[model samples]
Target: MQAGNLVLLLVALGAVFYFFGWRRSYAVSAPLGGVRHLHSLPGYYASLAAVWCVLPALALLGLWLIIDDAVIRTNLMASLPSSIQPANEVDYNLLLNQIRNVAGGALNPAFVPAEVVAAAEQLVAMQARNQQMMSIAFVSIAVLGGVWGWSRVQPRLRARQQVESVMKWMLMGSATVAILTTLGIVLSVLFESIRFFQKVSPVEFLFGLQWSPQIALRADQVGATGAFGAVPLFAGTLLISFIAMCVAVPVGLMSAIYLAEYAHRNVRAWAKPILEILAGVPTVVYGFFAALTVAPAIRGFGESMGLTVASESALAAGLVMGIMIIPFISSLADDVITAVPRAMRDGSLALGATQSETIKRVVIPAALPGIMGGILLAVSRAIGETMIVVMAAGLAANLTANPLEAVTTITVQIVTLLVGDQEFDSAKTLAAFALGLMLFIVTLGLNVIALKIVKKYREQYE
Candidate 1:
């Protein structure tokens, strides 16, 4: 049976066990002055039986699925003639792909050798047999587990505690998986970054002023000396992020304050969602706007004012990015401000403070930590934005702070380095990992700073 169908069958079996266990508990308790004689609730007994019926069967199904494909592939490879056997891992993978294609009727059998066609037939047969065996095993396990759990139901059984313990372990397992997944990602990136650092010095990658990463394979290649200096990228990133924040912070904060304190009920009901609609608009659409409309306007205005502005300027990208993230800051700040205790405001007003003074001194201070966190999140969003920057800000690694100049960011460089046909071992490609590691570190530092600020403000208020 298919995995989905098998899972459904297991669930049905578990449901049957649940009913049986519930009935058995009631049947056993009825003789001893009803269910009052039982140690735990009937629902807990039913849940414990359902868990017993499902867990072991699902575990077996998972293990079989993991090993089935490898075993099948290995047996197929063994059956192939020595002369036709693949010489390397890549060649073996290719051979297996062709076999799969033939088995699935994607490849015409008459065009290929008879050996390949025969192997495809064998593969189909083995898979059918494997599925049959798996279905039988899964059904048997589920049935046996259901019977055992039903038989185990007793008057004094602590089925509630047992079910709770199982759920607790399941939750812990889920948390462990999440933590391990994050660690795996970090370790993979860190290892690749270490390899990159061995090829290019960390000092040069971090502190050097230029950012070219094209390593030449031949001596005659031009402009491929691979200057891995990341300073220009960092400067451009900070400059654009600063411009975005300049536009976003005050506007978003003021909007939040107004929405939270001054807006009418009916107005707020419609206004908040409409305002936050910007967050739902795709970043690519913002990029298109930045590239087609904003960039041209800025360039045209600059030329009219006798200033030289690049066609793709940082100002255009930053402005659009700021507009895009405004919803993020405003929504978060509005929620935080509204969450402040109504009693605090009432107390402030009772102390002969004006509404404006109460908002500025009382409400703002109480909500400061959350507002700051929202701003920090917006700043991170600005730094990590790629599409608008790529479309509006041209990929020129010029180390100038001018918003009118075209520049590139770390993410842009990372994308550029890894694009097209590139060898993984080359410094050009490895440099992408180095850039990623740098970006990760910078973001981590920002998070640390945000946490410290939040903690300080929270302590002061509390």
Candidate 2:
């Protein structure tokens, strides 16, 4: 039978078994003065008894069904004939795939061997019979266990409390999975970065001013050098991130203010989602628009104003990244602003302050922590951004403050390091991990500070 049908059958059998068990228990517990003298309400008592046995037994059966295929496949692999054994790991896996497909009646004509075909047919027949018998046994056990448990239930049983305890443990298990997943990712990144640091000195990687990653391909090659300096890339990253923050913070904050305080209800409803549409645009699309459209425009504008600008400039990339981040800042700012108590706004308005004045002097200061938190998050995004800088900013590592000049960022360098085929142990590849570690540290530091500030603000408000 199909899996769904099997499940339904199990459930139907469980319900029938529960009802019969309830009746048997009730008959046994009936007092001398007929059914009127029974200890509790009949249906509640019945359901309580039924739940103790039916749910647990059925759950176990379902778990078995889910794992049965893996168990059977493992056993079948061990039982395969010595003559048909695979020559290597790859061939073994291929044999297993063929066996599975043939047993499932999904084999193609290309690679069918006569002995393998016979073996598959035999295995399928055996597995089908085995599964059918297992299902029947499971249903029987569920029904019998339900009856047995119901017969044991008494008026003093604390069934509700027992069920609640089980549910609580289930929730804890779910929470543990989520927490473990986050910890696993952090540990993986940390370990790889540690491996990278073993090969290169931390001081040299972090403080050295030049960043040339090309290294010798062979032991005999001469005049090949690899510099692990990270300062220029980080400087470029900071410069671009600062420019992005400059563009995003003011625009996002003002847009948030207008939407939250000043705009008409209809206008706010329509305009907020429209502005947020920018966030949904894919990063790759933004990259090309930065490279093909915005970079040229910036260069042209600079030339028209009697200034020299690089064709691929940091200003263009930062501008586009800032536009990309505006929704992140504005959406978060809007939430925090709206969360500020209406009574505060009313109090400021009652004291003869204009709406703009109240927003600037009172509301904004009250919400400053949250706004700063949003800006920090946007900064982290800017630092981590790769595609826009790769496409628009030139790869030259120049340590300069001028936005008009082309520069490379840590993310751009990381992308270049691992883009095509290369040895994983090489300095070029290891440099990516070092850069990633630094990027993680910087973003983590910002987040910690932001969270602390936000916490303090919340405590004060409360």
Candidate 3:
């Protein structure tokens, strides 16, 4: 059986074990007159049995999957002639890929050396044998665990405590995995960024004001020089984000206020969903909209007003991006505004304040922290948008503050740098990691500032 099928079978066996454990609990309790005489409920006994039946088997299955490929590769290399043995990691990877392709029938064996053909056959046979052994071991362990758990089910058994302990450990493992994954990402990006800085001076990359990354990594291949300066990218990112915030904050916050405090329940129900649906629209669709419709309209409008707007301008991208992030602010703000105590609204009204005044003074102040968090999220979303910016705000790395001009952001440059086949060790490619690190730093600063604002406002409300 396949590993996935084996997992399904194991789950079915665990369910069967749970039923037996549950029935045994009731049988033991019936002799004592009722379940009240038992240390734990029948359901707890069932859960404990299920956990024992599945957990050990699942653990073994996961371990088997992790090591099986390495074992296969080791045996394959050992069986090969010394002449066929790979001398380095790169050679080994290339040779293994050829073998895999042949084994998978993507490549014909006749095209490769006889040794490769033999290795491909060996690879297939080993995989089949491994799956056979894995399935048998997985099933036997599951059955043994189920029988053991069932045999241990007694009226005095601390099933609830055992099950809860297992659950707590599982939750802790999940949290640890999350923390480690985040740490790994940051370290990887940081290390690569450091490598990039070693190749290019930090001062030139950070402060110099031109943005051309077309220079070849090798001097032999069209290498005049690439400008490593990121000032323009940073300026463009901030300019677009600022414009987006100007559009989103007022519109999203006011709509949130109206929905929470003034709109009829039926109006709110439909309006909120409609607004959220707008948010759920695919970003690629937004990109196309901006490219074809919004950008042209903005340019035309600017020209009509005796302004020289680029066909693909920052204003178009920012405006479309603002519309895209509206639900981020509106939904969160509406929820927080609605969460304010009803008595606060009533007291303000009793003091003869208008409904608008009550909402502004009472509800909004109370919800300021959450509103700030939502705006921060929207700002992040706007800054991170690559498609809309690429499609509308053309990738001209121009360092102008005017919304009428074309500009590009760090994300667009990162995507461009990493898109095609390029030398991984090249400064041009590594520049992506450096830009990513800078973007991360800017986002971290935004979070710190938002948190301080939230903390200050939260104190008054709490």
Candidate 4:
């Protein structure tokens, strides 16, 4: 049978066994007359029981299947003859891939050496035997486990309670997995950043004013030493983010107010998603728009006002990024505004307050926490944005905050630092990790603060 058909058969058998047990329990008890016991749960409990039993086991089976190939390949590498092994780690890795492809029947025999071919054949045979044995063992275990679980069911089993507990644990496990993944990522970045810090002193990297990252490609090249000072990059990030917030906060909040409070339902239906479409446009498209359209316009407008503006300007990039983040702020603000209780509005109106007054004094204050949360998130996004700044804002890492001048951001610098072929252990490449670490920390701190504010707001409502 096909694998899918076999799975279906096993599921059907498990279901049959579960219902059979449930029916036997009911038959023995007959708590009330045939259908008179209103408290007795319906026969669907059997199906739920079958799902609970089968799903976990099947999940384990699926995980094992996914990992089995990698495990087998690693084992086969460990079994390779010392004479056949490549000299260096990189070459050894190349040989391992060739052996894997040959073993998996993806490579022609002519392409493989005799030793490799012999080893691949033996490994493939072993893997096939192992898989066959594992499959049989898994099926047997699943059947036995399902039968055991089903047999425990009775009139007094409290199956619903047990199911609920299991569901709660499943949800907790899912949450733990998400948290663990995030923690793992942070730890990895932190370790790499520490390595970078060892090469470049923290004080110099953090406080230095110059931001040039270009390094000598050859030993004899002579030039001014590349400075790793990060202040200018961070300053640029903050300047852009500030400009973006200035543009986005007012426009987004006002738009949200109109949509949530004043607009008719049909108008809202059309307008909200239309506004969100701004968010759907890719950042690369926004980058070019900022570079080609916004930048030139800003320069021309600046010249007309007798102010000098670079052709590639931070203002243009910031403005475009602000536009990109408007939906984030407005959508969240709208939700928070709408969540204000109808009773609060009625009470204000009854007290002779105008709609505008009521909204300003009561609704906004109530929704302030959620709105702040959204703004914080927007700031994080603006700080981390790369494409727009890289294309529209010039790479000159000006430490000044003048919007007319060019500036570089942390993300842009990180990209430049690591973009071309370079040694991973070099100070230049490792500098990217340090920048990444700082970015992660800043964003994480913002999120935590936002969450705390939002949580406090929720408590007020509750």
RMSD in order of candidates: 2.0, 5.6, 1.7, 3.8
Question: How do the predictions measure up, each by TM-score?
Answer: 0.94, 0.75, 0.96, 0.84
Candidate 1: stretches off by over 4 Å = 12-16, 87-91
What C-alpha lDDT, on a 0 to 100 scale, does residue 367 get in candidate 3?
95
Which 10 consecutive positions of candidate 3 have the poorest summed lDDT?
215-224
Clashes of each: 0, 0, 0, 0
Error of 2 at 115 (Å): 6.3
In model 2, pairs of residues that clash are none
lDDT of 3 by residue, 275-328 (tens): 999888999899999999999999898899999999999999999998888899
How big is the positional error of residue 328 in model 1, measured in Å on the Cα after superposition? 1.7
lDDT (Cα, tens digit) per residue for candidate 2, span 1-462: 655776687667667656765685467556544434545545555665566556666676678778887887777777778788889999888988897788777986357886677668767876887678777776666666676667665655554465467668879989999999978877776777777778778898889898888888775766266788889998899989988888999999999999999899999989999999999999989999999999999999999999999999999999999999999999999989988898998999999999889998878888988898998899899999989898898798998899999999988898898898978777778788778878888989999999998889878766
In what order do the candidates fall by TM-score, top score first?
3, 1, 4, 2
For model 1, where is the 10-residue window of minimal lDDT?
A: 217-226
lDDT of 1: 0.92
Query: Highest TM-score among the candidates is held by which one?
Result: 3
